[model samples]
Target: MGDTGMPRAFIPRPSPCAPPSPISVFATIDSPPWTLAMSTYGYENCVAGTFYGFTKTEFNPGDTFSLQWGAIDDGATPLNITLGRAGGYIIDEIIVGAQFTKTSALYQLVVDDTANCTLEEFSWAIPDDFNTTDPQYQIGLFNASVLLGADGVPLFGWQAWNPDFYVRPVSSTTTTDASSTTSTVAATATGGNTTTTTSATSLSTFSASPTSSSVSDDSTSNSETIGIGVGVGVGVAALAAVLLGAFYLRRRRKKAQTPSQGLGGVRQQYIQELPATEKRPPMHELAG
Candidate 1:
């Protein structure tokens, strides 16, 4: 073993159940030295004949990126590079000595592990704290198994896909605090989020609240008109009823006067026809 406490890899014998092996008892365990590199937007420093992969260069808070790695060979175990198992690190994208992973965690994207198969691939999404200005995030080969050399350093064997690249953040333009009168629509929304616009035509925005207000005004005007029409109709009906009542009373009075006058005239005519002698009547019977 090297000075480090880690143990070096060695060849293993065949199965005990098999017949006596004809091959030599001793063999050389040929392996390479440990290597570490970084990747960033439009840049990567990968060791020859190693397993590492990455899919995208830019992303937003919740966007996803694809990743892949090569499988470990037989009779070898992957080195656990993370000081904390299941944890890892990333290099700076824009500034030296700066940590890109300081803003967010690099998650492993894998489906199966029953067999640490080679040529595996997976995906991961950019975390909420992922920086947008310098968007590239680099990570070591996930799910890749490495052999520990005598120096206790991890060494890669083969790779399946590209290991490093840049992921650009999605750009957008939004508006907030937009208020407009009922006359004209404006280019703003309630949630304070707005779409990117180049010209006035592109920002032809509308507001439901303002439209509803106008509709309410029209409804009030219509209600007033309806109320006036009802009042006029009621007044006309009342006048017509009054005139009809007056005409009916006058006709009844005229009919009653006509009958009385006719009776008086007939009585006068009969008296005149009687002559003066007939008028004396039995008054000749005198004072008896």
Candidate 2:
């Protein structure tokens, strides 16, 4: 199997930690298939960038089959490989010297340990006629993770792109049409808090734009309230100081003024008046 390009036939092995549980995420058609050629890999109608290789393009009901590949970073850095809902095993980037040996980090998914090479199969069997009413009718693989930064900003891992293979009626629908949903999670870290969101929506030319004006408005309102509170406190303090100064000046002026007494009331004579009855007459007579 290593020499040839084909994978060897073997029983599906269980994961060491835990088997990937089948999730309800469905496959979506990002762009029209015309943009992506049958022979070449194109980024035409894809929402998130991915490299895919599957055994068959079309399948039927009750068919036992599998889609296998590795999760490569089309954009996000530190590319991580998760089993996801596709129920695949983790493997190391292989490098084999053979005519048809697939030796790419982003190509075929395989095991790192040669001793445990047999545990590298991502297999799934198709169910009978699927219920038409159910929106999630197709099965797919997803590479998803949320990265939190110290600034409360969120970075994403491999984006939730469409899977390699989708199970659907061949004639009824030529292209896969999967519905996408967004889930928001509140995440708190040691330094700051962040809001993590996982969305499967395709990145189209006319993708929906979110409104951040509400958050801005709330922040603005809070700032205004704080400013008003501070202004009011300062004004009140200034007014109290002015009132206290005015009262103190009035009390000092009242104390400085001398009190006067009526004729019947006894008052302290600061200066005693001597007998001045003959003084003016004697001066006038002597001058004459």
Candidate 3:
């Protein structure tokens, strides 16, 4: 995709009454259609919505980025599966990560393990034909894929579509003339926890840590820039220990609720989108 602007993402936040906790960009592991979540103040259950968590709000077509999350499957294992179909949709553009796999018109990613709840990340490349100029045309994943199947066909509750995502408007005089685009994104801090550094590069920068997400057209390579602050010190021992205790405490809240039946027995998920306009999100205090 040509330079439209930096890709943007959005996500949900914890309640104000919640305590200071490690923040993470994660997808919930539940029934077929899972939800994306992030924790800032404290731990909470997933909230279904028109838009889930994202570091940026709008992503430029061809912009490659990652979606990482920690989810526990108290309901059933989230297996990544794709149906034999004709063409590709927005969700099909996924390059596939971890449990993720894709065909021409279909893809599936189950970042969450069958049980362990830590972090798993993957990179996604938006196709050039994608809609970036219109929010109505903005693609949605997870909760909003009700009316879509592989290749945008009619499916009940699979990774069919996306929402609240957009493409940035290119400054006509600027984008075409420049060989590379340099843009600075301002960060919005909530509860004084999330902090993001504003930077820019020629290609476009996308990275994820335990804490927050920052996008800059600022890095030379997208893969090289990921996990920038994710230190090596978070050894398996530490993560395993923390997850053990955190798992039990969080597992009690793991019951799943099927989305109410829509017309023709299709599972339709009604959602209330939480504000994710804030730029970077912090990992849990323990994540540090």
Candidate 4:
């Protein structure tokens, strides 16, 4: 396919062991198709600051892949290839030729004859953290001269404005124990009498993962419910019995508190003792 605009310029790192460019992480996305075009030697139709022949876009963590440069026409000289976050490199800063070949102590790649070259594959052990948060990755092709501290060298690498590939998002279900253990050594000595005390506290805090409920769990729950219900019923029955006993005792006490009727009364007792036919004499007859 024709070039989809020009690739961006990439600045060479100061040192060989320089870190990949600091890139803000983004969610994983599907990769786009490769659009690098290349030509043969002498009349090499190669463009400056642009990588030519890489195809695959997305890769799984720890997978290996090959990076292709169409044709350099620079035979037997080593090249510098780097992978990092894209959109931040300058292309014109990389200089190629015999003087720049294999200048750095670091090794990027070796090409015996660029004109009759075969693309060699490279493997990147993608780290565990290269997931949903940070997916963008890119590669660059450069000459070893980019590493030297020349007085007036303004060359850059051939790279793209966007990332070349991505790492697929991995589900984060199996996170490791986030807690670290620490040991504090203690010693107590009293005239050669020594003791060691270990008061280590371990705290394991993680989300309570849901587990499949078994029959025993259901049975325990049901048993607890049944026991509570039976206890409440027994408590209510005991309360009722206590209230009935109190009511009966109160009635007996009330009856005992009442005075005896007519037995302790003198007129009523005399009238009851006299016969029913007996009558009292008149006052005049009594006087005569």
Report the poorest 10 consecutive residues by lDDT, candidate 3.
96-105
Who wins the TM-score comparison? 4
Best by lDDT: 4
Give the per-residue lDDT of model 2 (tens digit) for 1-288.
Answer: 012222222223234244233231222122332322222232133322333354465555555544333323332222223322232322211111101112322222333332322111233344465332322222322222222111232212223323544445545553332211112212222122322221222333225433356668889999999999999999999999999999999998877663443432433342344444554534455664
Ranking by TM-score: 4, 1, 3, 2
Q: How many backbone clashes does candidate 1 have?
A: 10
* lDDT tens readout by residue for model 1, 1-288: 223222223323234354321221112112221111122223233232244544344345665544434323321322121111111222311111111121112212222333333332223445556555644434442122223231344222212224444544444411221223411343352333343333333445444557879999999999999999999999999999999999999999999999989999999999999877544535355474
TM-score of 3: 0.27
**Relative to the true structure, how large is the alpha-carbon lDDT of every model?**
0.38, 0.35, 0.35, 0.43
Total clashes, candidate 2?
Answer: 1
Residue-level lDDT tens digits of model 3 in 1-288: 122222222223234354323221222232232322222222134322212345575556555543433332321222222212223223331211223332111123333333323332234455556544443333333322122232333432333333344554444334643543322222233222333333322113443431233334334346555654345445666888898989876765553322332432442222334454777788667754
lDDT of 4 by residue, 48-161 (tens): 333434556766665544443433433233345544565533323211231112232111232334544422222334545544466676665545533532333333433233
TM-score per candidate, in order? Answer: 0.29, 0.24, 0.27, 0.40
Reference-based lDDT, residue 82, model 3: 23
